[model samples]
Target: MKKFNIFLMLIFIFTTVFTACEDKIIDTTEDKIQTSIKVTHINIPYVYNVTNESDITIEGKGFEQTDSITFIPRGGQGGGTIKLGIKTIEDEKVALENSPYFRDGEYEIRIQRGILDQLLGRTFVNRIFNASIPDREGMTVKGTVHSNGQGVANVIVSDGIEFAVTDQNGVYYLPSAKKHGFVFITVPANYEVSVINTIPQFFKRLAGLASATEIKDFELFPVNNENHVVAFMTDMHLANRNNDLTQFQSFIEDVKNVYEEYKGQNKKFYGITLGDQTWDQYWYSNNFKLENYVDQIKSLEFPIYNVIGNHDYNPYVSANDWLGAAEYRKVLGPTYYSINIGRVHYIILDNMQWLNDGGSQGVVGERNYRDFLDQEQLTWLAKDLSYITDKSTPIVIATHVPLFTNPDQNGNFNNAMENTSELLAAVSEFTNVKVATGHTHINYRNSPAGSNVYEQNIAAVSATWWWTGATSAANHISRDGSPGGYAIWEMTGRNQQWYYKSIGFDKDYQFRSYDLNNIHITSATYTPSATDEFKGKVAGYAGEFATANKNNQVLINVWGYQDNWKVTVKENGNTLPVTRVRKKDPLHIISYEMQRLNANAEPTSSFVTVNSAHLFLATASNATSTLEITVEDEFGNKYTETMVRPKAFTYSMR
Candidate 1:
């Protein structure tokens, strides 16, 4: 009887262990199935009524009860995740409604699930036509979105408050409300609106909408080729100065000359201006004068895309953030937009935010400037990028202010975008991306933390704010001593190459060099100072050294220097190591000092010098021999300049 009892106990223990192991295997398989959710189809209307909530249904596989739906509205309205009203988890179908606050515009929807933070699927929806009645008798506005003379369907067209999607024939219509001046379209992927006179022709004014009915049609061209070239020029800052307009004309001539060369190669060329098209913002009272600048830019025959700068804002406008760009929108259309060229996607964003402080101009006084991209713009960016099917496509982001830059000694970031991390995060999935900006009037390149993307800060065309010193050789010299220049980027397949072109210099003139002896300084002796007194002395010393002996170190500023570029100094068939140093340009210091000592200096010559990132230093032996400097830009273009070492001079200062 004892043996039989023990046998029963053993059987019970073995049965329990086997059951536990079987349960573990089943759970593991179930978890794998749960996470393998696949979205097959989503049933959503192309357009919705702004005032009415419509049911949205999504169909997929492996959706669980833990999954949630999120709707992101475009045009600056932030969206939130929605509570599932009716869900069939087993069928993988979920239904939700548009948020009550959703306006008449475009929106994005996403399916999210699990603690691992996964996005199951995403799509876009457009809320067409205004829900509210028009203040005045409504006029029917109709238009068709066409690409290459063929109607393109499902394009979103809007009049700020009301949006409509083009039908199968690419035709759309909306009842125009009172005070609606323009009817524009959210340009579709792979197609761009007609650009006329450097201004994007995406909208038609209401003046042509006489008698309650207007017919407007948009023409979009294809830029889907693999080889294309883009010309980036910024900070024209055109004003009523003595030579400002003439300088702009000369810059245009240079662009024409360059474009002609590219045209000969049969390369497609596109032009983009980063911002600060006018300096009239200096007098906030004369905000209307911006119209003059707009007209002048519109006179350019080529279609030069533009982004908004702080100087483009109307200081007197007292509206909210969305309406703050009213005047700019009236002239420049959308402040943010996107276009596609070949495998490259280009996005232009307006990073300037109005403070509503009624300040006279930008970059003056403490707390004068703030950089931010409104939540709406961020939402738009996400939605726009979603439509892109190619994950490996390269993207080019252009804005007026740099998205990333080094802060000042006080930990202040006056020149960089405050939300850089967020922007970088949004584009992190894109492997090949670059940002181009113009505002500092200095040329430099920087890559933000957490990403390998590079942001190139192109120098201004109106260098030193149109300030030309009487003794200076060039009318426009940036405060950092970089010649006023623009950048030309050539994209072939997945590869891109760029070079900075100085306004009056040859294409090969990528950098400038100086004799350290003439500047009377070595990297060891040169110290950066913030005090006004010391700065004044340094400026004077630089001016005096320009005419002194030239027998010491060689300093070179490669305007478009990047980490990949190779710079070296050779003397007597021996190569010397070059040290990268943060030093202000000696020529810029001399220009500033000359302006201070000689009151006859041009008004634009008063710019303060800032540290240059591209400056390289190397010492040479005191032998009077030819010092050869060689620079190879990232594109493999080699530039060489030879300077003769001068005899050492001994000067005794009393």
Candidate 2:
């Protein structure tokens, strides 16, 4: 009986301890769930008058009594940190008030629970001029949309929620609440909104308490034509220095000249800089002033759009890390917006995310990184796409980072969109989609296997980060041997064609070649072999000549090589197929190595060309008299260049 009692007690104690442990685990999990807050909806007006304090209700999940809310101004003047007073808090609802001195722009709201934080929502606050009190009925906001002083009908105007269409006389009227903030337009197709002092003049601000109706007018530039030509330039990295501005102005002149050259082709010219308009570090030091750059860009005859790059972030003002883009919003209107020109819908996205850590130079207060589109942006994109009822309309997505890219030499992805697969899935329903990006400073085009979308990664305007002018080339040449340039894309209804235009070079200058004298080539393809000495050489001869042994080889780097493109070499009038090679441009390698060897050499390159996927190789006997290289791009543009067989040059191998 005594033994039985002891065993039963032991079992009971064991059971008690196990139950307590399980309870503890359950408690920890419940706490985690409570801290994982998510915002579902916000009952804030799209626009709030700056003169009045507005009440906003935030509805979300995972709210605790200890939680607090904050409002951070996004862009424009009168922006700083303003904590909202939470009048009430519930499990699903939190009511807060905006500051009386709120700014005239978009504001970001955030929720803080202990050490955990999350973005609650965003609202736009504006200052309206000559406003009045509302009668029993709301006031009316009227606007007229015109193109080059001529009325344009069927234009959609809105106040971020209610929309109105312009009449035959190009006039639109919308009922506005007494506390309305801004009256904006939807920007009709084949037309561009006017920009004043770098601010897109698509909206009219309403301010003060009044009793009269508001009147605003908007002008859009027409771009309707058979051939619509748009320029894609990226990574200007304009510093505050005069030299950088000079280079950028020169590039702008080149763009103007290109427009002039094609003026007689019945093409309408428009240009957009993909991103990195200004290096954040320099701009921040200059007190975030952009008047000069804005003036320069505005001087362009054609309408030019801007994209938000990682380097264009504003980090000094806001305490919230994600609010670094506030300056960009102030300087440039909304960071992400869409416009339609003819049959193509151009969606500009802000994918650069600020890390809050110090930048590369460690001078800028904050570090900005790429490849993230927040939830708010995703929601906006879905809504924007829903308005496009015509599924056949081609879509052009322009961003700073590439949505899809080939892996680096180590078989790893670099500087690509983090949510690429998700983004692609969202746009998968669209048949014709082209993504244009700039940041890699190399020109590349590829179509993912099953996506059927062509992604073009353009070279930087400030080629090699403004390092090319000191090299022997003395031009804006990227590390990939692609000259710093922009791309010209022509859209005709649903069909599109594009080509990279080097700033100073003619359109025909697409590729460069090197002749290798008789070196034993055993590989059937020009692809870099593990045993090939030339593939690893980086400090040998410069320019288009390479020593060969028993195998006479010809190497080529087609800067704009696409899958549909083909390269063929005719040796002594005999046509021979050229094999694609994974090798770096010999010119880039030599230039970089020479600069490295001589410390006194100017910093003429930012990246070394390690391996190029667009390279090609062809081999022939030493007796071959001449070599004629022919390249045909995807659009059936053929370019041929002939070179005389040169005697083998000797140089010490690296």
Candidate 3:
């Protein structure tokens, strides 16, 4: 039940637009200066869509006092208010002249008040352009993208397969076959398109035959973001279950605080979500779907360019991959697109092909998808890269799954994305290419030996599926012990830097040190009051720390560790040997594992504490010896921890 409030005086800003009485244009105006326009279905509460342009019939009251009608385009397109005089006038109904029809897009209609000062319906119309497309030679779609009294040049435009760029006059034409039935732009640097409900309107749907021609245009506002800060958010997995809403609110607040802190630094802020905004399993059961996901983050001040994860497909549309992604494409623009922020050329891809094996009209499927780029995406990537002449431009390929998998205990890497070779070869020319991804629910950076591409497989915002901190409000740690948070990327011209920001903690909180002396998770102490089903379910040392040896050892979990990062430990003012080791995070074991065990429930294996390669081990001289730990990333930023011997480890320890 969301409403778009429209006032008659809005013409000075948005509009007192269009005479068409369509959609639920609820009159929420405060002044009551004039009545609003509404097209109420006589038999039922229904609003008609803009189906035809020739026969524009508006049936509503207060039409006698209506002077003119206007149509305000959504998402801040270049064209101003499209006002039209009423052809027929009456107290109950009226119709505009059979001309000046709206193109294929969303628009808000408003009533121009007459001298009598009567109220009218301020309606919102989704104009459906089903006209006969004209045939053209050499170009199928053509238009000019202009803004602020002039045309902007060198902007990239595409229809998924074919790519083109605007000329010096800001005019471009695509010789497209209309394969995807939509055209979009790669919103160039220093400019941005407007948005509706947090979704960027960088694309427009097409009409008619493949051989037909259609003209589509996009206008944007110029911005100064050469030195910008983008919030790399990912893996929301919002399903209205396990208190996810509460946790998501906390995430929003955390982002807002971060933005406010950096608001006055002469830098613009933007957000990019790595995907999994909603769970398809709960779309029908909880009555919360893609639209609900948009409403959740509507309070944010900036527009969020999104990526599509495997869980964001239509579960019951297994008839085909295209059908499965229909809802996502309809709700959140295109599945795969690109945009420019500063010197960074970002390409957002949809690698998860929804092969929902056993789905149907009303039945759920296996909900399984793969981590591979399809042929079409690869082709589009090639077409997009062809337009960029500067090979040194920092390219960021954002997908849901990592292109390269994280290394294991023996420093061995496995192929996660099936199309890694193709993807690598595609971007091999770029000198500073990087990939940002999620879905592992753990933080890890993958840098192949001599490859130009680097990957940061970030963790989830809803850490551990919002389970660890549901009731206790403690330790919202990921599988690798990274706290529930997002990545902060600072871009200055061609140079880029990033760091993992733990929510509820400062930016300097990079690593956590655990004193083995005070760390032990035993069923006797944690699940002592549990029932028989889960009495001895918990284990000490979490499988790795199962032994009873009282070795004076310290384990440090550096969630943001990479190959070039350095770790050092000093005990009693003397340097101690530090070795990289794979082990489970103890705090995660107590915060998530023991919590479920104490509740007499078998903990999910996926959510359980697992061995992480980012861990380091150091042996101390004595149990009472104080140790100082320092970690330095490749960017030369250092974080330190001073361990006052037998440092207490608790579920809520920071």
Q: Top model by lDDT, which number?
A: 3
Rank candidates by TM-score, best first.
Answer: 3, 2, 1
- Put down candidate 3 lDDT per residue, 205-275, tens digits, no spaces: 76535665566767789998789998889889899998899878989999999888778787888888998
- Candidate 2 global CA lDDT score: 0.67
* Highest TM-score against the true fold, candidate: 3
Over 4 Å off, model 3: 1-135, 208-212
Better of 2 and 3 by lDDT: 3
Backbone clashes in candidate 1 total 3
The regions of model 2 sitting more than 4 angstroms off are 1-184, 195-200, 203-217, 221-223, 240-242, 284-289, 315-322, 358-363, 407-415, 471-473, 517-550, 600-606, 647-654
Lowest summed lDDT window (length 10), candidate 2: 520-529
Candidate 3 structure lDDT: 0.78
1 or 3: which has the higher TM-score?
A: 3
Off by over 4 Å in 1: 1-142, 147-149, 154-168, 172-192, 204-216, 221-226, 282-288, 318-324, 359-367, 406-415, 449-452, 469-475, 520-551, 600-606, 647-654
User: Of the pair 1 and 3, which is ahead by lDDT?
Assistant: 3
Q: What local distance difference test score does each model get?
A: 0.66, 0.67, 0.78
Could you give candidate 1's per-residue lDDT for residues 366-442 as a string of tens digits? 21347887776787688767766677788899999987663322222333678887888788888888999998888
